[model samples]
Target: MSRLALPTVIALALALSACATSNPDVIGRHEAQRMSQVLDATVLSSRPVVVEGNQSGVGAVAGGVVGAISGGSVGGRREGQVAGVLGAVAGAVIGNAIERSTTRESAVEILLQLRNGERRSVVQAQGSEQFAPGEAVILVTTGGKTRVMRAPPVTAAPPAPAASH
Candidate 1:
């Protein structure tokens, strides 16, 4: 394989792996301008958790192509053919593993209690906001996805002035 081809294949794999995200801070384009249900709750407990990675075939395909080309350039014609097949298989497995590991996310599992004494558990990718036991938070749900965020302090509204006749 040409030196340039290897780098291009690697760059494509990296770009594809970066496409998956479960971060609470990131809102998808489709979610914008949509109304969400908000519920008040208090954090009962917070714990660290791991969000599993995804398996998309793009990685395997990319790796196989790169490996075949690279291995095909090795040894005599017959030997190169055998090596190419083996390299493609090995490369595919390694690439899939890389994709999975790169996409894994560090997250948190939160147990919360609503004002009505109802309890809910949520696991989300760790974001800028952190939850602690006894901390007040709001659960915002949009399109069936929920995110927990710190709630603003309650403030009493000022009285309105009398209206002119």
Candidate 2:
């Protein structure tokens, strides 16, 4: 394989690893993961969340490598080496900026009052329902993290049939 600069190599690695955050144990799209606590809570309030962008440096390193490889492909050997170095530096900067901007996510912060009379706040990804104050919701907690969602409705069972004469 052709030689790659450190930055270029790093950038490529980051790009390939973008999907590492996906959960492998997910059984279904809408199902919640088993939690330590599942309780009904009242939504005291909710606020929009602006998640910070990633600063993993993966972009810079990966970009640098790609830039270097393409740069080295041009001109003579000595000139190609110089171009590769320049390309790597440029790639790193571009990659980092692109990653920071693209990786940002919108979320929500919910303040809940549990049935146990304890109050707490949770930050979770935004779902179908936009939370509102005074709403009844369910709290699911696991590993110190919590998610607030609207509670499923209770249904009454049908009465038994009468005996025939």
TM-score of each: 0.89, 0.70
lDDT of 2 at 151: 81
Report the Cα lDDT for candidate 1: 0.88
Give the root-mean-square deviation of each candidate in angstroms.
2.1, 6.0
Q: For model 2, how does the per-residue alpha-carbon lDDT over 57-159 read when each residue is reduced to its tens digit?
A: 8787777777788788879999999998998899788878777776665678889898889998887656667878888888766665556768889689898
Candidate 1 clashes between residue pairs 3 or more apart in a chain or in different chains: none
Where does model 2 exceed 4 Å of error?
A: 1-36, 155-165
- Cα deviation at 50, candidate 1, in Å, is 1.2
lDDT of the candidates, in the order given: 0.88, 0.72
Candidate 2: residue 120 Cα off by (Å):
1.5
Q: Please give the TM-score that candidate 1 achieves against the real structure.
A: 0.89
lDDT of model 2, residue 160: 89
